[model samples]
Target: MAAIATDTHPYGRVSRLFHWGMAALFAWQFVTVGARVLLPDGALDDFLWPTHKPLGALLMLLVVLRLVWALVDRTRRPPSLNLAAHLGHLALYALMVAVPLVALMRQYGSGRAFSPFGIPLMSGFEGEIEWMTAIGGIFHGLLGWVLLALVVGHVGMAILHRRLSDENVLARMAPHAGQSR
Candidate 1:
């Protein structure tokens, strides 16, 4: 059998790079969140918590890029293995976009300045918008936790697919050369 081209096989290099890169970032984000929740007021929480918003903002950008790339490469990229996988991916994308956006909304509504990576995204104002802040305060963290759960389920399903199915789904996303489908 011939080896599938990167664009036509599992995922292109760019796709994999986005996937793994965002995975690492999400891991860091979770660590920061966990520390904030479990070790509040401690040095670890203080250290990691500060990165949460900035990192979330970064993830939001990356996810948008990834979505665009996926669309551009859709014809060449590997097909979804099943309906479940397709729906799961859609949910992931939805949550990924929503989590950061709501947080940003809250930040803006709070009338607080936010500069992620030293770029001024929001300027502080005198009065807070109660509804925007309330919506974000309610959903941001809750949706974030939901996203994390979905991620865990995603990984679990991938493992199950690899172990039980005839096809090795992992090969599509795994870092390897000359993969075939």
Candidate 2:
């Protein structure tokens, strides 16, 4: 049981859970965004569009939890491959927190109620706050795209580490079936 939970050059179970779970959710986010950009008011976009805000809220919650878990388990986690990896991850975390926060600000500023997953987060206001909405409108989509690019770079670097440096970085987060440590 200790072995199952402890990191031995590989990520622990909880860390891997957060990593992979967030990866899937992020993938869905990208798909939804892609539909919005490429398909617009088409059927696919229409179907996926409604999920965008709610899922963003969920991702924000997960990211906050993941951040806290990472801090608590810092001593038990695998080390960054290098300075670049460390900075890249830091940027990813920053954007993960920033993107949804800006959106929430915009939602609130727009004088609209927001109830993601049916939990009332922001109540409707009588009038809009221009500055908050403007800031959110300007940065939210831009930062989201930047984060996606960084994620692509992150995955590429992991594969490059395996092929070029013989470092099985992905294995730390995604070990094979029946494999431990």
**What are the models' TM-scores?**
0.92, 0.92
Instruction: Report the error of model 2 at residue 27, Å.
Output: 0.9
Model 1 has an lDDT value of: 0.87
Q: Write the per-residue lDDT of candidate 1 for residues 1-181, one digit (tens) a residue.
A: 3433322367778999999999999999999999989999999998899899999999989999999999998897888878989899999999999999999999999999999999998889999999999999999999999999999999998766656655566777883533434
Model 2 lDDT tens row, 1-181: 1122212378889989988998998899999999999999999999998999999999999999999999999998887868988999999999999999999999999999999999999999799999999999999999999999999999998776655654667667876621532
Clashing pairs in 1: none
Report, for all candidates in order, the number of backbone clashes. 0, 0
Lowest summed lDDT across 10 adjacent residues in model 1 is found at 1-10
**Model 2: lDDT of residue 98:** 98
- Superposed on all Cα atoms, the candidates' RMSDs to the truth, in angstroms, are 3.3, 4.3
**What shift in Å separates residue 152 of candidate 2 from its native position after superposition?**
0.2
